[model samples]
Target chain A: MRLSVFHPVSSLIYFAAVLIATMFCFSPAIQICSVVGALLELFMLESKREFFRNLRFTVVVWLAVAVTNPLFSHKGVTPLFFINGRAFTLEALLYGVMLGGSLSAVIMWFKVFSKVFDRERLLYIFGRKTPKLALIITMTRGFVPKLKAQYRRICDGRKCSGTYMSESRIERLKASCGIFTALCSSTLESAVQTGMSMKARGFGTGKRSFAHSFKFRFGDGVFLFVCILLFSAAMIYSGTGKLRADFYPRIAVSSEPLPMLCFAVLCAIPFILEVKESLKWKFCLAKI
Target chain B: MSKKTFSNLIFLLLIPLLCVAGLLFFRDKLYAWLSVGITVLCCAGYFLHFEGKEIKSAQLAIISAMTALSVFGRMCFAFLPGFKPCTALVIITGMYFGRESGFMTGAMTALISNFYFGQGAWTPFQMLVWGLTGYAAGMLAERLKKSRPTLLIFGAVSGPAFSLIMDLWSCIWADNGFVPPRCRKFFVRLYRNDAGILVSFKEFLCKITENWQVRRAQSR
Candidate 1:
């Protein structure tokens, strides 16, 4: 849904609120709303194939948790069935389903999180706060493709030397190990040099500054403020304990519809933003 | 161990104990939050540990290279169901460098590899286990370097140790408590998947560690 149109910080704050609420708020309605919102945003952002791929994994997780939890935790009343003389209670089953829903919702949000917060955005968001860690992560990202290339080169060299050839699986395995060892020593030596060279270049001395240079535009500020307002309203309402649902002994729902509506609106912010953006685009097209 | 690094290690150690205590106290409802808390704390702790230290760029580069190598090793072995050399390589890094470096290498390997493999709730648990493996190797570095057998034994022991922690995590995740039978089942399934690589894993790590040990001695 063009989440990247918002600033990284805005996106970060939005996801953080949703995640905290989903994990902490025990209301089934809130959790369901959060999952549906995340799924809707995911559908907008990803192709059908990719969306289904993610859905498949998350659904499996939900079903597995929902089905297995009741089997192990036999703590509720209203037994639905009995296995080996232990009553499989409805409360436990519902509780498990509730747990699964929240857990999967969290996962879905993170999936959306990963997709939206690509490398540059992450670097922009976290780079300044922890420069050394950011630098390491950046360097590692830069190094993987290079290292993979080097590994391929090494394998090719072995193949050319006739050392890599073998129908015998053990022989190829041994050659691969040799190749790995060779790559290790070379990389380690170069890395030591890289470290020493960095020492000469005056790194990690003090005030290591970084940012991908993201502009906090007027639109970003508006988005962020809206997120905070909605988040606080949802949280304060949920915090009053009116939005909590208790499943032990029997399912007793204690929630105000207004708080759930607050949460649902907060969750749907992405969709609203996308619709607004699309409408603007269509307006501009008509003008053209 | 400098005070900062030592304190950092203590923090790392305290988190899991606190997690267990939390699970016991809360008793079944807060596990998803608990996992989220763990993931955040581990990343924050790792960041704070390295943020302002007099760590050289070379040291940073070295850690990046080690992490890249470990991740590359993992990707290379992806075809084989469970024969991952990532743990053994991480242990080697720990044995060669200090503990913090080891922990960084191990943790970063999990984080970066998951970019390709797809991250989820399990990422933090994997990072914790692998990082601890490296940290333990660093702590026992003297013994690990002194003899071939000890190095081999540590390598041999680390696979099961990694699986043990992950299996424990799954038990907590699914059943919401320590269901022993479920844990045992996970352990066996994991151990069986891992059995094929243990011999070569240990042997390869011992050889690499021996090479570095000699070089380190010569340099000193």
Candidate 2:
């Protein structure tokens, strides 16, 4: 009873399909999907410890967005009321929570998507003619790691110098200036070095071939087909002119039932699959 | 890039960004003292970095005085209700320094200060706008430093002019937050508010603008 999940690409296709569907539904369904998606991703950490290593930053970002958004927006009718002169409206807080959660979820999902359709895989799929696209993929994939590593090294260097005084404002600013100078210089150098490395490897050469790790099995075909169906249905719903933006002082209600149901079905697919896989894993582990 | 350098930059950027977010969120309670404290801290930070050199002392004293003037102007602006003269602090610093230094100062100041107001997503844009204003002021300062009267004029005009520039940036970011769909009226009202302050300080604006225009026109 070991749980089996779709390949990353297939998983991504399904997620994208669901997202597009939810967007077309033009109601509160998008918020639900986003929150559910974010929670499911978060739960991945709780249930499977290994996933946390990859998702910790993402989760923090999501939480930050969720927490801070409500604090600032201060909109809506439901009176949570009274922080100083400002009346923190229940509606604004809730909306901000939804908006922030959804925004973070979408951003994290895209991050996951990039991880799934990794630079090498995408490059292999797209081939050498598209250098700009390849460069973008490489940078996007590498960005977080680069920033994280850089942040750590600078802190370490400061610590080693015994100049790392977190308590003093002036000391921190000097350290920051030193760090900024160092960062700008190194980044420029790295850009040049990376360019040279690419050239040395004959990046522009037409002789390169890529063999992707993901093979399109029968299951993959089913996943892709289902995604296509979902995406097409979503697009059709949008074409009928029912999709609308409800963001402002108030959230809008959707008129069409067909769009809503179809949207719900699409958005709920990933959650269903994830739950199925998790439960299956649990049952199998119990037997052991 | 070396791992060490990259991490350092992120850490530096993050501190100010988070601080600003905090500032923005809590600005109502903290605005009066927080702004003054940050302005002092920035100048103090500069002084501490250079230690006890004679030139450093003079520069530090000047910045300290500037910080005091900025706070005073800001407080006076509050009383005047719509006079936003303190936006010149970053611009003046930038003008005196070069563009790069001005940019760094402006960005860092805005980011750090915004923390007291309460940090949100808008912090980055404010940093960028303020940084750009500083950079522009620095570039302009270099071109006008030749004559005493022109320098004085530039100094006088920079305060209110920068408020206009910063407002334009804020308008772009906060349009969704407060502005209605038909925002032409809003822009007009904003322009009127800004222009009204300049009109009240007519002598100051006139002196600065006259000198600025004469120099600018001469250069052309």
Candidate 3:
């Protein structure tokens, strides 16, 4: 049960929970939960540095979006001023930033989830009857690695062929295009062969059996119960419109920060205990 | 650093000035292409010139100024609205500098400014539009600064025009349902009310004064 925390099911459940909570709750609920989900994914996913780096990138991108958005959107109750014959309102810009931050957070969360749920595991979970779709998802999962490998190959080739480091952006873009074309051609060929192999084995037609390693355990049940409680509380606050989120001409109070912080802490309890256990073991070993 | 470098900088400035003037004069395909082409060219030149070079303190300061201005502008628009862009500060700053400054300003403004505004749906296009605007401005500035008059004229014309550009960009996003169609439609509907129209007209008058103030501030 402790080991399964490192598995894909956790991420799946996390993703599903985020999606459901975001869909059902108010906008603030979506924002807060999504942020909490991203934070958890960042801290507990083992790839903490990568997650933090991506979070920083998301912040940078979110700022860019916030600046450009307000000029066009002059909506909402409070009017700040007017620019160039337009009534520029704080509401518009606030909404833009809120929307942008939520989006970036969601994207960051998904990326963290993907890191935990690699293609092999995704296929393992859904492979028996829907082999074709499973294979596609698995292949899609490797797209970034394949693309990077091909890009490196093209770069090496270009350097070997006397392409200087001082090439223009356009030239670099063109070089990448060449690499992409090569990769696409090869990937298509491989896909065809894979399709043929799958057809031969009757991959799509079968009574599906679950060979995946997600066992229903006591800890998982306990974790899920706590998750449900937290989510239900979030949903209650959100659905009642009691979870306020305002920022424009003043500030919007979304969920109470303390409660959200407490929820975040509760979610981390398992990982915290795991670390404490490990540290205890190490201390015992040193004593011996 | 040298007389030749100074002269080269002046020469580079002319190209963008011409592009901006051409865009204003032509108001069609050539105008759009002119700014875009000159910007791309200047960005290429900047890359070539500054390749592998560490940024000087002054350059870093300028970059920070640009980033701060962008963030300030975004926050103002989001929370205060009073300090919103009467002039396209991002565009002007970018044009005066280079692509690196422009891109950073554009990108950072969107992200940091959202601190006051919760994350919403319309962020991606906002990032792209501002980014392109800064990138274009920098390129134009690099290409057109041969004469002071041209620079001033381009600055004046672009300041007001940028507001229009943003409005149009919003229209594209709104009509296409890219994000916030409901919010947009609701606002427009509200504006269609008689009181809203009067308020909008009053806002228009206020905007002109705000624009002038921004211009004066920029000159300093």
Clashes of each: 1, 26, 40
The order of the candidates by DockQ, greatest first, is: 1, 2, 3
TM-score of chain B of each: 0.81, 0.48, 0.44
Top candidate when judged by TM-score against the true structure: 1
Candidate with best lDDT: 1
Instruction: Point to the candidate with the largest DockQ.
Output: 1
TM-score, cand. 2 vs. native? 0.45
Evaluate chain B of model 2: give its TM-score. Answer: 0.48
Residues A53-133, candidate 2: write the lDDT tens digits.
536655676566555444555565565667766666756655555554544555555434443444465565434444333
* Regions of candidate 1 where Cα sits further than 4 Å from its true position: A75-92, A158-179, A196-211, B1-28, B31-39, B173-181, B190-197, B210-220
Give each prediction's root-mean-square deviation over alpha carbons: 4.5, 17.2, 22.5
Of the true interface contacts, what fraction does each candidate have?
0.61, 0.00, 0.00
lDDT of 1 by residue, B36-72 (tens): 5766676667657666566767778989999988888
Worst 10 residues of 2 chain A by lDDT: A18-27
Which runs of model 2 end up more than 4 angstroms from their true locations?
A: A1-12, A21-25, A45-108, A111-129, A135-166, A186-201, A234-258, A278-288, B1-220
Tens digit of per-residue lDDT, candidate 2, span B1-220 = 4444544544576446645643443222133223333443443333232222222222322333333333333332343455543345555556554565455445544544442233333445455556666677778875655555564555456545555555444333332333332244445655667654554334332333354456558879
Model 1 C-alpha RMSD vs. true structure (Å) is: 4.5
TM-score of 3: 0.47
Candidates, ranked, TM-score: 1, 3, 2
The segments of candidate 3 whose C-alpha lies over 4 angstroms from its true place after superposition are A1-11, A22-24, A27-37, A44-52, A76-82, A85-97, A142-166, A169-179, A193-212, A246-288, B1-220
Q: Mind giving the per-residue lDDT tens digits that candidate 1 earns over A43-162?
A: 877899999998998899899878877776777879889999988899888887987898889888887888888889878866866777777788888888987899889889877877
